[model samples]
Target: MNKNLIIGQFTDAYLPITDGVVLTVKNYAHWIEKKYGKCIVICPSFPKFIDEDNFDIIRFFSIPMPLRPPYRMGIHYLDLKAIKRVEKIPFHIVHAHSPFSAGLFALETARKRKVPIVATFHTKYYDDFKSATKSDFLARIGVDIIVKFYEKVDQVWTVNSSTAKTLKEYGFKKEIEIIPNGTDIIPPENLEEYKEKINKIYNLSQDDNVFLYVGQLILHKNIKMLIESLYYLKMKGFSFKFLIVGTGKDEKYLKDLVRKLKLDKEVIFVGRIIDRELLKGFYARADLFLFPSLYDASPLVLQEAFALSCPSLLIKGSNASEGIIDGYNGFLSENNAISYANMIEKLIKNKPLLREVGKNAQKTLYRPWEKVIDEVVERYKELIFTYKKNF
Candidate 1:
């Protein structure tokens, strides 16, 4: 164990925003600081949002991105005070969670300090660029820039092998490391107590089938298809309560679609819950975790749901569905609303099978943050040693 290990985690999202990458960065900092050594989180500032964390955080100047609600574009160079504070820390190695502003800052800091820097390729940026710009040429240019950024880093990492394939498709030919994200949720001994609490809070009855989707409410996540699937399920006389957790830019559009599809009674948009305990309770109560994201590279929510013995339904070929064995540990569906609806109906019909699958999911997918960070710390040490030897 390195008692003097000092880490710097640079990310575009933090505290106020809840997403896969944000959760990954939070867990990395939390575990690293708790068991390893000191860690400093450098992220964009959210207006009037006071960070309440045990570890240190450096909030740089930023403005909210209009296209993506609650996600701010950080301008670290503009914050001279924050830069001075960052310069004072003797960081052993720096890790970047995004290739945007915060990542650029990490690259600069690593070069200035002459330390190893690791950048994790988490999102499908090309899809994001195409969705934002509506131009293939522009999206390609953006991807090229992203590849160049990863090339400069000491090491490149992805949450899974599927995501590494995506990075290679985008022109990053370097050897990529696979370090999966972790969850802190542990199944409670008295799970029914938490489930009962969730039932009362959500006005759900024990007999009603409960489906959950916990992540950003965006179109790219195929939330529209999830709602559409509910419509088909409702038409077949299947009574289920679908809880849509978290908020995003597409929330309003999704709500409007739900109303238009006459699924307002079946689907409930439960906005973002920052309380981890309450969130875990929802996972415990859910009969199935419904996630059909085509854009997510590696979803942290899937692991969080699996941690509480909740099986997830993901798209068959999606990057997040890499480890899942359809119907054995988790369920899979084609990229269509009817397939999702049919899959949901099939799973709910067999309660014993569903429960067994949930147990299997927990056994196979749940990886604690402590163990993950132990591996991360070892990797950091190896990177630092290799860099020093070559220097």
Candidate 2:
């Protein structure tokens, strides 16, 4: 077997996006370099700094995204230009993240270069379209675009099994691989100190149970539902603090709702904590992690919380639900605020259940990056071999 493998990864969003897709690709690229011989990452250029000498970066034109969440659609002209640049590189396999411009560009580049293309389904754009426009026609059109893009790739990889089933429903004939995103476990020493500092900073009392919500504060994330659940818990005389750790356009709106509900003392919005260690510390200290997202393929936050032994209350109708076994690892609830509140109340009433779920959740582990990369590399070799044989 050839030890030297050249892999090309393309995504529309990169660092500064502060979302799961960008972080997943960045982490995967770093792991590939550490485990494999060589790899290159292609993304739209940003003003922010990304220091990785081993990996090559191909910058392209990206439009300013407004109310689109983390995705800023890449221009076709710029993507074609990026495609040209990637075609010149010697890569054994091409891995595309987004099914829009970057994925389209990767498909073209792979076909021209005669390299096998592997696409990882990251975002649930169809779900986002529904939340943003609330138009079935627009969502259908979005689904059509994504279906066409993935039809050309050799192998499809979804972050979770539910996403894989979704891809199959969209007429994807290729074998779909379920490779859930993995997070580096936070060291115990770092987590312990981080917990004390964060609690003090947020003015969280030692007796008050703190529930953490860490992700983009948007309509799709269902932050309003989370706030309502907190209100419900308060009504029940549950002494708990809700920590909001993220920034988005909906920040002010969520804060307003908090005030309207008179949850001023109960809710704290700590915007965009960039430090990974500090974020993990908050996870370690939290009594429960709340994820009210209505649409998500595989949220890294849920995985991070699980890894840190923080039991979560994840909303149903998302790929993240694949990891939850109902009352075992975490609670899954309907999209409605009332339903979510019911779940929260259940957790508050049964504190022992929370600890039991968290203990069980720690056992549900994801495939290591080395194993995932090895599977990818083996797939690449098979593709190369088949292509050579046919030729």
Q: After superposition on all CA atoms, what RMSD does each candidate show versus the true structure?
A: 1.1, 2.4
C-alpha lDDT of all candidate models, in order: 0.91, 0.78
Model 2: which ten-residue window has the lowest total lDDT? 365-374
Q: How many backbone clashes does candidate 2 have?
A: 0
Which candidate gets the maximum TM-score versus the true structure? 1
- TM-scores, one per candidate: 0.98, 0.91
What TM-score, to 2 decimals, does candidate 2 have? 0.91
Instruction: Report residue 193 deviation for candidate 1 (angstroms).
Output: 0.5
Off by over 4 Å in 1: none
